[model samples]
Target: MAWSYRKRIKLIPGVHLNLSKSGISTSIGVRGASITVGKSGTFLNTSLPVLGLHNRQRLSGPEPPSDPTSSPSDRILPLNQSRGNIFSSDVQEITSQNMQGVKEVLLLAHQQRKELNSDLLKTKASLGGSKVKLVISYLLIYGLIKRSIPEQIKSDIESQKEAIAQLQQAVEDSYVAFEIDFDQELKERYQKLVDSFIQLTGCAKIWDVTGAHHQDRKTTRSSASRLVEKREVRFSLKSLPEVKLGFDALCFQNANGADLYIYPSFVIMYSSKTNFAVIGLDELSLSQSYVRFVERDAIPRDTKIIDKTWAKVNKNGSPDKRFKGNHQIPVVRYGELILNTTTGLNEQYQLSNYEFTEAFGNAFRDYQAAIRGTKQR
Candidate 1:
């Protein structure tokens, strides 16, 4: 749906806030590009640059016919002549004129957000103060393989951990990124995992999954060296492609989509809001699908069968025998990962409509940490 049109909470020009049931977010943009700023950061309506400079046209109503009868002062600005650009004097004039109004609207929205945040906090607390998010679910399974962490690998991770964190923060803002030394084989493997996730999720593009303010994104590595500590998999957005959606962010319905989709960290958030160290999976991970879990058992854990069978499909949504069964597929354990976030999701929710418990969470975490020369948190 065209949300901008549907959402009536217009603030200053090109600024809209949704305080409705859909969710809490400030959509700032006009037509061609918009960024929904929520508690989880921001999401884009178009894949523009960070500064939002682009030639792409926004969806607009047909232009009004020119009228010689109209006075010059009465005429509306032409679409192309509306403003110089995001940084031009024209845009400066517009912002100056609307600054007061913008501030007022934001102030009002912020108050409402505070109230709503309190309410949401109460609600989630009633259910559970802490939740074990099915962190690795949206990821592909093939990426979760790990072997013994070489001595060099351990030293590299410790030395570059700070750098890696900085790189993820930078990449999330837009296309900017940093190069880190890391294992090539690991990079190639992580790529497959992310690829599998996108294929199964039915998302239109990578931007839909993790773009900031709808800016462009990519996975890049410097052409520097190999067998080093920092690398693509370590620095890429895919590694930390997650936003914690706490009570503050869940006030809007739009925010729920990310809760269901998106690459996530398996970090446990306690009542104190302290996020446990994330357990990154390099091989097959265990996940519990709420929808599948619910549909299979209305009463919670009511599903009788221990090992249930389900149908399968190709990405096109058609039935295909190429899909393998649990018994048919070899259990690779730590040596290899069954990277299939998308495929398993298809089987549980779309095709078969059931959830498989990652009953292997603890063991898998130990294996993953050991292979990375780290301790499981």
Candidate 2:
């Protein structure tokens, strides 16, 4: 006869086992008594019919159809009491396996997280470094521009200074060789020419008829007919490549301080053959004496050449009643030459427009030379 015992084990929530022994026979089955192991361990029984029957009872139960949908917790809860009867070592082994699996999964997840964090930190540092580089590059460019600005300004200022120096030198050179006393000669020559022209023309004069009839007629006639004449002329003399005489003298005031004069440095003479003739003086011969005359007397007197012309008076009035005398002739002062004629006398001269044009052209040509490259002193 043999004896048998049954045992049950629970592994986690989803697994279970039932073990039975009878004589020399052994078997294992699930909760529904479907045997998965049979005759494998101590289940061969030749005697002990009671133990065999008990074993058979332990193995026998209602047929268990496969339950593909049964949950592991549903299977496990029914075997909770049976688990106590199983080997503690086997239960501990199953629990350890589950715990090891969980730990491995958690550790893998933790390793992945640490790797991600490291990658994020590296990316952030790279971005920060790039930003720092960009800032430094901008600062370097700005510094270069700031350093260049002063040099550019200095170059511009230096160029301007050079231009100013050149202009100053040109002015000084133009005046360097000029003579001091040339204006005096010009004044004397101009006066002589004026006197000669006036006498040669034998122009009419205005006399007060009242003076002829007065008891003091002798003195009055003598004084009135004395023919006080004042003449002034100014012209430029810069067109001629070469000039013989320079400005001689500038007559600025008369003995009575009522007359003013300006010396001519240019002249134009009209003749039947040439039609127009131009004379020019050397700029190198213009004197400080002439400048003095302008400064001291002539400029202060504010005398103008137009005031001396016969055109100052009316043609229709008697000598005594009019503000200016009758017998007033019209004089066209062109450059240094005085064109003296009565209003109708110019018609007889038959001077062509081309002749006047040529004379004015020549005068302007010389005038340009005197002013060019020269400053007013």
Candidate 3:
């Protein structure tokens, strides 16, 4: 079952603090209509109290029109766009799950972060105390106090604010990155793989094929169906092709299409869509195979031409003589790389280059094993 949380608390006249699972926002206006600003975006909300009707509309950052061609179908045209949440900005919102994992892998400057947070908390507490004292001193001015408490508190707050600013800059600069490293031979192989990835100038198809069954059918209405179907499995409520990959940190797309980045302690299944996930090298599984792709369009530079087949083919590999103006289409051999984990991380990518993709997959596994051996010692 799915669940959600939302609440509205009135802070003052015509002011409300709105809270929801997404984030916090404030609304300004009467019960009938108001403008709200939140982490997702700004919105205009209106309601009819007597009629028990309400309407909400986003008032900022209009979403881009959906691309009609992006939908999955039986058509031969491969999907051309990144298969995830459509955001106007390049930055992806980090989902709540696996956030701790992200913090552990990235944010290598832990000590600096700790110190900065401590100092900022102390300074803010002091500032808050000073403000309270200033308020009390003004109320009791005629009774006993002679020194200017307001001026003293003002000076203290200013100095503390300056100190807080300096600490923030130091925090930003003191951290060191824990980047992935490769040996000389592995590094060369990795670079070659990266080159192949960059050179994939054509659309890549990601296929998920389950078990196949043999079906026998007759032309009569009482006979069984002729077309057999295979189920496309969904992982975390997303298709296999929708998974993303990244190099900086191990990243995975959540059910809501948000990203969760983790430390790269194992295998990195990078997607061409700039999303990635990290799994332990030992637990990760990889498989590489050549796909005999029937190219209806221009062949990619990285793929190799295997053979030719007619657009209208018979039961065999030959062209059907009954069809007129039948043309031949090149059969290209493309590389398919499949990555899987016991935890349901299954991603498949069809790369244009077969040799390099296979080489990288094999070498990467060997490199992971070597690293595991060193760590065990």
**Number of the predicted model whose TM-score against the real structure is largest:** 3
Which segments of model 2 are wrong by more than 4 Å?
Answer: 1-145, 175-223, 226-377
For all candidates in order, the CA lDDT equals 0.24, 0.24, 0.41
Q: After aligning candidate 3 to the native by TM-score, how far in Å is the CA of 113 from where it should be?
A: 7.8
User: Model 1: residues >4 Å from true position, as ranges?
Assistant: 1-180, 203-277, 280-284, 287-377
Q: Give the CA lDDT, 0 to 100, for residue 193 in model 3.
A: 43
Question: Evaluated with lDDT, which candidate comes out highest?
Answer: 3
- lDDT of candidate 2 over 1-377, digit per residue (tens): 11111211111111111221110111212132111111122132323221111111121212221222333222321111232221111211221211232222223333433443453354345445545544564576863556554344344344333333332332222110112232343334345544433332232211111111112323332211112122222222222111112433222111111111122432222221112222222111111000000111122121222312222222322233334453343222111111111110010011112223234323322332332322222
Per-prediction TM-score to the true structure, in the order listed? 0.19, 0.18, 0.43
Error (Å) of candidate 3 at residue 141 is 17
Give per-residue CA lDDT, model 3, range 1-377, as digits (tens): 11111112111112222222222233322344333322233344555221122222211111221122221222222211243211111222221222223223222234445655676677667668767776787887831365655666666666666655655554553333332344454456445544443333232432243222223322121111222122222222122222122343323333222333322233333332334443444344555555566667667666689888776666545677777987888878766545444444544445566775566555544443343332211
Error of 2 at 165 (Å): 0.7
Q: Model 1 Cα displacement at 45 (Å)? A: 40
